[model samples]
Target: MISALAHGYGEEAINIFNNMVRSSMKPYRITLVVVLNACSHSGLVQEGVRYFESMTRDHGIVRNQEHYACLIDLMGRAGCFDRLIKQLEKMPCELDGRLWNAILGVCRIHGNIELGRKAAEQLMELEPQSSAAYVLLSSIYAALVFKKKKKKKYICCSWKVGMGREGETTYGGDWRDR
Candidate 1:
C-alpha cells in the first residue's frame, strides 16, 4: 500500500483500504501512517482530517507523537496555519524536538517569519543542544536575506541525445529572481 502511494497511486491505495475494511480487517498503526502519508501526497486535506479524527474516535488508536507529527505536517502543507498552531497548543504530551522542528520548517517555507521564530525559540527552550534547531533558525535568516537581496536567479537544464543526432542542449536560464 505504501509502495503504491509512494508511486502516486493514491486512488488504488484507497480502494485497497476500503476493501480491507469491507473484509473486517482492522487497520493498525502502520496502515494509518501510510494512508496519512497518501493523504498528504494527494493533498486530500478533508480526508486526512476525517481519518485523523477516526483514529481516536472509531479505532481507539491513541494518538501518539508520530500521529500528531503527521497531522501537523498535513495541516501545515495545506496552509492551515491557525489550526496547526491550535493543535500544537492542545497536545497533551510535551512535544518532542522533532515536532517543533517540523512546524518550524513549514513556517519557514511559507514565509511566516514570526511564527518560525516562535517555534525556534520554543525548540531552543526544549532542547538547548539541538543542532537541528540552530540550523532551522539559520535557514530562516538565510531565506530572509535572499528575499531582501533580490539577486538574479538562473535555472539550467541539460539535454542529451542518444539517437542518430548526437547532441547536447541547454535551456531556461533567463528568469530573473525577484
Candidate 2:
C-alpha cells in the first residue's frame, strides 16, 4: 500500500490501508515508513504530518532518522523550508550525511543559496570525501554563474560511461550535420 502511494496511487493505497485496518491487521514500522514516504511524494503535507504524529501517539512507533528524512523531504517539496529546518534541528538522533544532502538538494532547487551553502558545509564536515557534496557545490556555483550570464538559454551537460569493445553509442545531432 505504501509503495503504491509513493508511486502515485494514494487513493488506492488509502483504500487498501483502510481495508487492512478494518481487518484488524496492525501496521509495522516499515508500513509506517512507506506510508509516510508516499505522503511526502504526493505532497500531502497535512496528511503526512497527521500520520507522523499517529506513528507515536497511536502506533507507539518511535520516529527514526529515516522517518524524519521522509518528513523533511515532504516539507521541502511543499516549500516549507523553515519547518523542515526546524524539524532537522529538533531531530533526537544524530543525522547522517544523506539527510543533510537531501536538504541541500531541496535548497538548491528552491534557489536558497545561503541555506544550500550551509547544508553543504555541514555535509562536508560530516563526510568530507563525499563526491555528491562536491558535485552539488559545483552545481550551485554553476547556477550562480548562469544567473550572471543571463543568456536566456539552457545548457545541458551529458556524458556516458561504459566498457565495450564491439559497439559505441553516439548522441547529439545527426553525424551528417557534423
Best by TM-score: 1
Off by over 4 Å in 1: 3-7, 151-154, 160-178
So what's the TM-score on candidate 1? 0.79
Global lDDT of each candidate = 0.78, 0.76
Q: Compose the digit string of candidate 1's lDDT tens values, residues 19-122.
A: 88789888888788777767766777888888888987877788788878778777887888999989988888778877888888777777678888888988
TM-score, one value per model: 0.79, 0.75
* Per-residue C-alpha lDDT of model 2 across residues 46-165, encoded as one tens digit per residue: 988888888888778898878877787778878898898788878888878878888887777676788888888899999987877778877777767666766333333456565743
RMSD of each: 3.4, 6.5
Give the lowest summed-lDDT range of ten residues in model 2: 169-178
Clashes per model (N, Cα, C within 3 A) = 0, 0
Model 1: per-residue Cα lDDT at residue 132: 74
Residue runs of model 2 more than 4 Å from their true location after superposition: 151-178
